[model samples]
Target: MMTHWIKSNSTVFGKYLFVKGLSQKVNSKKFEVGKTVFQSLNGRDLLSFEGYTRNEVYSLLWVATELKNVQQSLRLGKRVGLIWSNPIAKASLTHASQNLESSLCCVHENQLFGSSNNYEMLGRSLASTSDIIFLDVPSWSQSNVEEFAAGSNRPVILISSRDLSPAVVYSELLSFYETYGFLRRVILVYLGPGNNPALNTYFTVFPTIGGHLRYVVDGVIESQASWEKGLRLATKFNTEIKQFEKVDEAIDRAHAISTCSHNLSHMHLKLKDVKEMDLDWTFVQSDSHKGLSVSKDLMKAAGHSLIHEVINNQSWIFQACIAAHTSDYRPIIQPPRFEGVD
Candidate 1:
């Protein structure tokens, strides 16, 4: 019963990017997709090539395993909706979409390696499999959403970057988003000028009654990852609510450490040109019906340990990936979008 109120253009979580980036760099030079034989590498290839290397293998495990933990931490719970293109993108998203909480939409299904022309055929099948759907905002249309909405239960939708205001589309079908028993999460990516009044003006149309809305702004990764590796990072911040109903012993165990400064507003974030630091994160308490807050200094301190948590959580996801590898390669298409539907 947790929800993430994230807004921004780019926000990715966990150390998966660091490991995957390093692996990609190595694999880019070593393995050449179809050209390099699976057995050619002397030890291991970090980059993903179909299903051949340790990096690729473990990466999927990372997604299937760590995703659940991270989302649960944010209270996205067991069901999530992820939007990214390709198998690599699909696998990279493991951290957020793990277990049954995640549903994926390949926005550029037209570009999949072995894409098929039977668009509706794949669309109908995808509708049957997932409870929610994710789509690039520009590509989403009213007709397409309605067709899938016809089949889904508590479905979710995603729109990449603010290129297309969600209002134009959602305006036509306010009822779709407000459907009974459905909890749709709408994510808008704000790369920069994230606070444009034009976009904010349209916010009122989106119903909060049965949906979750988040603005995603990118945040600090490690200084090294952004500069040295050409990596992209986003904040995977968390909030802890003090529960009044919990046992007294547990309450006594809870503690908060104040930092030397409220650096929450400013940190010597590196590669400023290459990154965006979101200064605030909000936490909600269900029982108290009140909001809690944390300082930037506290965020910097707590976030420092993400790498360790990521490493420790890997073993189980890896096992799960290995078991599901063969069957996981099947194609999962996003339902088709209609042409020129307002």
Candidate 2:
């Protein structure tokens, strides 16, 4: 299914640009240097998929895939800090960073505010000392982001849920108003949402990438304007736009489904719902199986084809690795150790 998505846009980048790591496997025994060519995203923030070019998105995915099965330590010597509003989010990311040699300073949302100046000062202080900072708090102050960007031009990742409240969405737009090049270095990664920004970016670049591009917006997390924008884009690209009351109905006809519904309780992708889904069709969910939209059994059934937030989890690792390497600190790849055979 992914191959169909790739083949549809194969000629867009022309012949000169060869995508890396599609068919290759990482060598676990020998140490190998990453031969990633310097790109615009190196040492940059990844706030959202809104501003990324198609090539950049594609390259980033490939690099992330390469690093997914990496046997080496992604232990960057840099100081990476995380400021989270949600405890669940904090837990997931903290667990992912166990291998990394980062001094992860967790700043709760309540600790981030005081006076207007104090808020900006806190952001600056955090940015000044950290090599990479993750912002999972709802909304942001422009002054604070400006200060954070000014300190060292360090990469600031803005994480958003699949279903952002109307108020939070407004705050996000306001905070992203950066004229001082802060956005260029900012990477936007989705923690949850059905209308994923990464998928939107991919389809935007390769509009005619084949297959049906249908959107099921339940208004749980998406704003009126945002979903409309998606429809407008779909129409412009000659893609069919359809609606389904149940997600299973959509899955019945779809080659793949990446579900992230904010309804929480009423909506879920269970084993019964996916009975009609083709075995080869891909399945993805943002969160784990406890009280989430996707059930444990469905996740297990999806198997290797099931992607659990690759754009969110693996992209963060890729960005961290790239940031470390660009700053003259290469990630330490652990050499294979043979205990008895050697």
Candidate 3:
């Protein structure tokens, strides 16, 4: 049956079986067998495993397949390493390991809170291991991706925020390239909207391969203050109460407005910190997680904004900021409490 599945869906089933075979062997190997075992499996090995009805073999196969996909994605002509910091380091590592096509390596606890040289050494060691290195350090200013790239042969990618500013962004990119030629691409992931408009304008001023900019509107949108009162008045008075008439009319007008425009306006407002007092009108609102919430209206608006940004700007690298606060996004995956810098 497994063989038949492989023959029918060779692309999918073959990968599935290969992953299964690797899991069975990983328990015995001390070194990283994930990359190796996946490469070894072929049709013959898969067919042999299928002959045995052992549930263990089946379970191992499932894990192997998933890991294989991740490995292949990471090893596709580019070695990618993810660096994390503080509380977010672990979660980011877990997510990157599962989702990104690259190996996830965290900064050591001792090195994290140590001297600048220690951090530099750690970054160098990590850069040496892969073609692409993602530094999840707290402040991009303190990070030394360029130092690591001095000895590295691959590209170094840094994930940072809007607070870093365009000047900081340019300085880092220039320093990396000048110091170490390996800093081919610097991908900045900006999270705050505090200076998004200015940041957007700044990136447009210097659009180049050396530094690619991406923005993330990282916050939730809540319903307008009037929404609750309007709901209550409508429920209590129905159409008979003249006092609630204006509320009803406002609700109708809000509903008539295109949901996309409303959501987009909401996003801009949230980013710009636009308050109810500033708005002459009101619209329905709800809290969204990292990206748009599951609502069709909000999703469309989010998608439209993303598309517009990408088209207008070159190398706009936008992504959902899973970590809440700036400090929450740490780069060191595992470190003792004492080792963390304030």
Candidate 4:
């Protein structure tokens, strides 16, 4: 009957064969009448198998099951930090950082540091401590790595999206720090003039990736598609703001602006000054500017990728640590933090 079952259900039999291949000691001369049953017996086919003892088979199965559970638990509770250089990268990281925090049931912190323009500030921040840090800056210099490993005992993970040059990517990852630093303030300024007070105020302080300053103004009047895009962006922005320490203000602003009706034209007009402003100097503007020429889909894809990298990279780090330790044991690492110079 078992032979007939194996013949009829080839797929299941194939899986069994694959598992059997994981072992090396299959006795070819055992139980000719019940060969299939003997093969099906656990641990009998494993390379580690000595002789097919029923007790050993049960123990092997229990060990395998326990190991699987341990892996799952490790993945579900890993903490991570994400830091970025540019606005697009920041947005992507923000989207990703939030998702990872939720999926891993871990804490995710976002950071933004000036690179090229203010390498000193960037160095100071990245050189701080973090359990895991993802650098999304376009250009990375050697000094950056030295600073990253300056004070913390945490691991710094670097990520460069395809949009960045390879040279820059290499420089960023190579920059290491002993400790990771946290950004003090991430201000989001809304630069659009609208009858909807809610929209203006809500965008003004919406959190961006890397906890840097984000300025969202009216770029252009929203088409049907643009309106939908804006809604999605707003939804993400709203969700993350709730996780911030001072969430009550964000919640109040969101509630106040929820009832207001506005168009994309108003947003564009409000944000127009952003493009024209000289980014070389620190100047605050309340007007909108010409936004990025990319399509909404491209922007959304970037955001999705950013989130995946943040989550998966942490998982990779955890796996690497596990692999390094032969035992099925995990070490508890503290969250990375920046230690300011005394």
lDDT winner = 2
Every model's TM-score: 0.25, 0.57, 0.30, 0.23
- lDDT by residue for model 3 (111-207), tens: 5544345544655676567545545443434224445445444444444321222212322332222223322122233333323322332233222
Better of 2 and 3 by lDDT: 2
- lDDT (Cα, tens digit) per residue for candidate 2, span 142-219: 335445555545676655433222112212212221111111111122223444433343233222211244444444
Pick by TM-score: 2 or 4, better one: 2
In model 3, the runs with Cα more than 4 Å from the true position are 1-79, 86-102, 108-111, 115-119, 142-145, 151-153, 161-342
Clashes of each: 16, 13, 14, 44
Q: Once superposed on the true structure, which residue ranges of model 4 sit more than 4 Å away at CA?
A: 1-78, 86-129, 161-342
Q: Which stretches of model 1 miss by more than 4 angstroms? A: 1-83, 86-92, 97-108, 112-122, 136-138, 141-143, 151-156, 159-202, 205-342
Whole-model lDDT values for every prediction: 0.27, 0.43, 0.28, 0.27
User: Sorted on lDDT, highest at the top, how do the candidates line up?
Assistant: 2, 3, 4, 1
- Model 4's alpha-carbon lDDT is 0.27
Tell me, by TM-score, which candidate is best: 2
lDDT of each residue in 167-277, candidate 1, tens digit only? 112221222212221212222211112233212322322222112223222242212221221121111111111112112222132211111111222211222211243
> How would you encode candidate 4's per-residue C-alpha lDDT over 166-192 as one tens digit per residue?
212111111111112221122222233
